[model samples]
Target: MYSDDIAIRVNNLSKCYHIYERPQDRLKQSLYPRFQQLMGRQPSTYFREFWALRDVSFEIKKGETVGIIGRNGSGKSTLLQIICGTLTPTGGTVDTRGRIAALLELGSGFNPEFTGRENVYMNGSILGLSREEMDARFDDIAAFADIGEFIDQPVKTYSSGMYVRLAFAVAVAVEPQIMVVDEALSVGDIRFQNKCLRRLDEIKASGCSILFVSHSSTMIESFCDSVVWLEQGEIRDSGRPNEVVRRYVDYMAHGVNDSGNKSVFDIGIETEQSSNGWEWIRITDQNNVRALDDYAFKRIRVKVGEEPNASRLPCEPTVIEIECEFLALKPIEFPLFAVGIFNELNEPVIHCNSNNLGTRMIPIVDGQLVTCHFKATIPGLRPGKYLLAIGMDEGLLGAHQLLCHVYDAWVFQVLSPRSGRIQGGYVQVQDATINLQIMKGDRQ
Candidate 1:
């Protein structure tokens, strides 16, 4: 959780529950008697205190991909509930910057009396979407749900697949800025699961921030930007998806895992807050469309600082939308410097660094600082955590830096885009214009 680039800023966030042996003891805590405190007694009750999330704080910038990784009871669900506003934190503030949709629990927000069509509109509205928006994507949702005429049937009669299909259709169709999915895919059919993954790619493409929770380290390592490994309601490590997953996989594989809670990377959130604004980009070399095997490091920059919602990044958005005041920190680097991504294994992944791609070579006026974005398409990583590395190619010799003991910045897991004919790559050369001409030879 980044305290700086705060999408959902959790300031000292904590959730606590009071345990009681007897049901009557619970009645006392909610409605304590004067006798409980006046006797100078420690409430002489067989009750315990359990903290789901203890003093946790971090910021998520818009469009940043994040993964929440932990064992069961590590407070992953509790933390997500707080973020999704389903459960109130015992202490601290959670500020959500934009529309949010959470696949936290199956059927978390469903009305048994409502039909699939009606529920889509209802659920979309509840998730901060307007009726008009839901109406626009009505057919799209139905097609994805694949419930056929069940769209008119009451949800009370829905099979688990039908229920999830309807719920998921509505969740992703709402165009959420922050989407939190918690093992929602595990329940669906493999075909539906793959469909949801495809939709996820579209959502990310549309600049939605996401926080995902899953027992599958493969998912976290392959798809999330950075993962938070929690243990017993506290964060142990947060960084690249693959590195954290590797540690997690190793722990599970070797059965030496004793933390029974958080992940291996105890690296806390560094980096300050970042603005969220975006302009779509396609990566390329100066020559032309890029091939999959090519690694041509091309230089490009985008004129920035022209969009709204510059502050407060959503949880899983890939395109960052944030505001900037343009401080003249000549050669200004950030809290975590450049943000990049990798696969699940501990190998060198791709990254974007000002230090590596020298953009300030030409002299500038004393205080002329303008906002610009540097985007590069990172190819060749096989869907897990390649050890994340950062460097500054400052007109010098090989100075590759695996910053921090764990270099835990830029955590992203790849979700294959749904577009069937066109697959993975930076550019879209498949699109074209078709023109028909009259027959030159006057053939019949």
Candidate 2:
């Protein structure tokens, strides 16, 4: 049993399956164990043991949203199935504090032979809701699902998208204290996915614990309070969403151990200094190719405000200047220079371009040493490491030829402010002024 504050507690949980090399081996595995037991001999396994999960332990506190991420066959689905009580673990214990609504598989809880209306009530009953309660919520569920007349049709006739829509509708309509989702939202259309995300945010705001599984690191980092990285059925890392997701991404990209060297994108921390006290770091040596045209980025450097060595803080005044030098393989007319800053999750937080600033640029000839300069007052980004990207293109916004774009061209850090602090959000707006107005009530 778990404490009241713990929504779901899984202790030393594990699940294993028998892997047979041939079809007949499954039959052998099933009968040989019983026969050996009856013959007063030890039962022998005809199949190999595949542990989908091994000694996995974690707790989801009530009202906390936790995300699970891993590559395919890493036991992410198996772990969620066990936690949702659809699959029993081979070892360890699972405890729950409240009603759980899960959308693990498409149409998992629905009866394919039954109508969508019938399945809705059936699912509600399984979740311990009375028929009367379901009846009152039926209209709302149907509206949310937007299945139209298909609600009266058999579930077997429904498309994959329709099935998920109705299932998500029923799951959220039940007002569960805990929600378990396993990438089912990816089935629906973009509009539906956004709608479900908004509803999920509402559910989290209502004090319901959520366990979400997705391959999207940005979603996990932005949405979940904490993250768990599962690798080969074991907990590889578990902690804050940003740190764990970063490591998971690094592992995925490099396919190396976490104890390995810094990631390819992380090489910008090492800077080279000149005798004149100017330091420049390499973001990446890769060249961006577009339309069979290749432009080589020779160098890119950043200067923070007036001081090249000044430290930027959250909610502070800062001007960012980016200088890029590239070799144009072909002639380009009026090339556009752009700079982008991304967070640890690689999501762009701020972007500026020469066109946006209404700047005029000169043309580039073949084998030209193209130098681009960008100057802007950068926003008050969160206190963390930020990646800088530089891109050079030609032509209009919608129709343009990308000559070269260097991602992670440079990396910078924003320090915490000594006077104040900006916590919990990505960007903090500078200069705050509060105004209060009170009106007096009059009586007749």
Candidate 3:
């Protein structure tokens, strides 16, 4: 028996379909199997099996909102259908503790021939609501739908937006304990989407569990407490929203048939380092010289510990140095030197520059090399590979002219101990303290 706190439990869930090459092949297979068995001959199969989902397992606690993210044909809809009881699973089981209201596809449950009002009543009845209960909630549902005169019109004449509006309205009107929404809000306008989100927030406040699917990463990050990423037909990753989303973005941008020869960022230094301590790792050398109209990056270097080629430990401090040379023969004015660190997903984690720190570059003589250095310890960086980016600009923060910007100028990795506190996130908290104080009046 499931505990009271568990809303949904799915174990070894799978779905499969049979594909036949021709219509006659399906008919022959259906008949030949039975006839061959009677004739004491072995039966032959003419169809191929396609597994839409395989051994997918996860659980949702009560009042928790979980987001589902995946590309098309990733079995997201198939899994939702099985949970909503619209489709049967070919293997495994899903145990749901409460009534489920789902808006899977546009115009799925509504009858095209029936009016909007009729469909609402039919859907409510399907959710186990009596006629009197539907009558009591009819006005609220209509107002929430806001399709004014179309309430009396046939649903077949409704637009996609109108269909989603009515379907979402009916789903929420049933007051289900579990709500499943699948990219339906993408069709509506921003204002309508905000209204729907507000209503969902109210429902969630009443202890309803939500399972949402959307392509908007911002929405998932803002609304979901946890996330599940699906790839091909299985769960690729599941955890905090920010971590999973970043990995998913990286996979989509870099991992698709990527040959080792063509990388977005190239490492200039050799892979192996000398055994000498505190060796200088050159990220950009003279061979990587690409000149802009104003200036160009001459070289980039980082000083590390004994194992200069290996991933740096989080406890170690490193120094990054960059050199830029003027391309034009004229004097440059107000030049800015900048450096940034980005994850593999191209999300910027840190950005620092000389201008922001109130340090201005001295007037550069023609063809003179200018150097800038940064030294710091990144305390809580989790174990992963990161990229360094460098750029030179002309003006202030908002109105800067880009002289030259190089992404992935250098690649580095962070190595953390297994028992470290920075286990699964992008940033680490170096020092954290908690204290409790008692009030005199409430003291026990």
**Looking at candidate 1, what is the lDDT of residue 24?**
85
Clash totals, every prediction: 57, 1, 0
Model 1 residue 230 lDDT score: 82
lDDT of each: 0.60, 0.81, 0.76
Q: Tell me the TM-score of each prediction against the true structure.
A: 0.57, 0.71, 0.64
Best by TM-score: 2
Write one digit per residue (lDDT tens) for candidate 2, span 1-444. Answer: 447799999899989998889999899888888989999999988788999999999999999999999999999999888888889899998888889999996767889999999999999999999999999999999999999999999999999999999999999999999999998988999999899999999999999999999988887998999988898999988888876776676457633245223453445344678665556654443322222346767676677765663434445657877776788878888788878877888677888787887887888898888667777786677788877777788886778777666655765688877766665677776667789997788865
Q: Which residue runs does candidate 2 get wrong by more than 4 Å?
A: 37-42, 254-275, 280-301, 309-340, 348-385, 389-444
What tens digits encode model 3's per-residue C-alpha lDDT throughout 118-224?
99999998999999999999999999999999999999999999989999999998999999999999999999999999989988889999999998877786688
Q: Candidate 1's residue-wise lDDT over 1-444, tens digit each? A: 445445677788899998888998877766565577787765555479999999887667777778887778999999999898889889988888788987878767888998877888888777666778777899999998898999999999888888888888878877788888888887888888888888888888788888888887766766778888887898876766765666665455433333323332333222333354332222221111111121112221222124332222222223432122222323323312343443445433445545456644343233444433444433322322222322222222244322211133223333433443433333233335789997678667
Pick out the ten consecutive residues of candidate 2 with the lowest summed lDDT: 283-292
RMSD of 1: 17.9
Ranking by TM-score: 2, 3, 1
